[model samples]
Target: MKVVPSRSSEWVGPVTSQKRASAIIEIDRVSQVFQTSARKDHLALSNISLTIEEGAFVSILGPSGCGKSTLLYIVGGFVSPTSGAAKIKGQAITGPGPDRGPVFQEFALFPWKTVLGNVMYGPRQQGVRAAEAEAQSRALIEMVGLKGYESFYPKELSGGMKQRVALARTLAYHPEVLLMDEPFGALDAHTRTRLQNDLLNIWERDRKTVLFVTHSVDEAVFLSDKVVMMSKSPGCIREVIDIDLPRPRRRNELLLDPRYQKYIVNIERMFDESDEAGAPS
Candidate 1:
């Protein structure tokens, strides 16, 4: 078994590691305010600034309604921030582009399309030749462990299988950053764990920059290079902890590792503290 040192600290700004990679996504003092049905402005995120390095897997962990998904949406260019800005590779994000791909909790697969057809959609829309698109899609489907299920429709597959196809579809476009918003939240515990392991396997192959949002502390620590903790509703960064676990992490090994256990305990402690501090006196 391999061991690596872990560090925890209050996140003030960009990580100051000696080997800090270039920032692929920059969220500068971004804040989002939405007008609720009651006609009052509700602050979803408040002055949230974050920097995600290229090819890094970072997870945003927070309590429910902490604006984790809102922050992700800003980076994905799906929703504009009420204030501040989000940039990709130093360019302001005005709208959705191929550089960012999102996989949501909902399978979001086309019911009419087969697994192969769904995966091939992105490349096809990008104008790749049909033969080439099909070839690429087939490879992706296989890579996601859905090899023989190529012709199956979304309705015919299980929850885990549908999520695999959704992931393959996103990967087909060759996006630089993968913005996953609770992609496995809808599945059963067993299936979620399987997909989580599969996701890491596929991610290890390319190391694409990934921003994952999850409520699970263990899941965050298990999959991320760094876990960003956020405050309750009207979210703000509370801390950013570096997870220095060894690569090709096996769940069984990590479950028993002291360092891995420490990470989870410390994070859960922080959340408990946050909750206590927010409680009404």
Candidate 2:
């Protein structure tokens, strides 16, 4: 495994010459403000700027209320920033499009629809013929490890299975980027780990650009090429740490690897320091 240098928040240099040339998503000085019932302005994200290279798995790791999901939604074009802009492949993002797919923590599956029906919905909506859509959906369901459960409805599947269907549905339309907002957050520890491993395996096939938001340090370190740490509310970039571990990472091996352990320890320490810094004097 090669040692990779981490960059501070102030470091504006590109990750590498190759990545710099193929920047797939660009967020330029984006800020989000919301008005509370009390009539005060609440700033969620403050002047966040980030560049994600094509096929890179990037994790947005931050504390709760740090606007991590808000940022993800911005890139998905689900919400408009108060200022600045987000772009995909050089075009400004004005609204949600098939180019980006979002998988949320809430399974968001149609309880009325079975696994096959749910996964096929996206393609059918895109005007794909029913037979073709079913074929693609069945393949995706199998790829997500739900081969025999295609006919099962959301109510009949486990939480993990539901999430898998959600993932397949998102992938059905062939989005260029995957915006995953704590997609595994609702699962038990064992289930979450399994899904994490499964996600990496599926990701290895096509290497779709993924922007994953999570509060877990270990999860971020394990799944991402770069982990972008954010500050507390009115979140800003705190640091961007590049994971230098060799690819095709296995959970059993990574658990024993000193480098992986160090990354978790160091990131936790940074979060602790940030908390202390924000404590009232």
Which candidate tops lDDT?
A: 2
Model 1, range 1-281, lDDT digits (tens) per residue? 11123443432234543332478888899999999999999899999878788888999999889999999999999999999999998999999998999999997999999999999999999999999999999999999999999999999999999999999999999999999999999999999999999999999888899999999999999999889999976788898888878888999999999988988998999899999999999
Model 2: per-residue lDDT, tens digit, 1-281? 21233545432233543445678999999999999999999999999989888888999999989999999999999999999999999999999999999999998999999999999999999999999999999999999999999999999999999999999999999999999999999999999999999999999888899999999999999998889999876788898878877778899999999988988998899899999999999
Report residue 274 deviation for candidate 1 (angstroms).
0.5
Pairs in clash, predicted candidate 1:
none
Query: Please, what is the TM-score per model?
Result: 0.94, 0.94
Ten residues in a row with the worst lDDT in model 1? 1-10
Candidates in order: C-alpha RMSD to true structure: 3.2, 3.3
lDDT at residue 206 of model 1 (Cα atoms): 84
Q: What's model 2's lDDT at 210?
A: 94
- Model 2: residues with Cα > 4 Å off, grouped in runs: 1-18
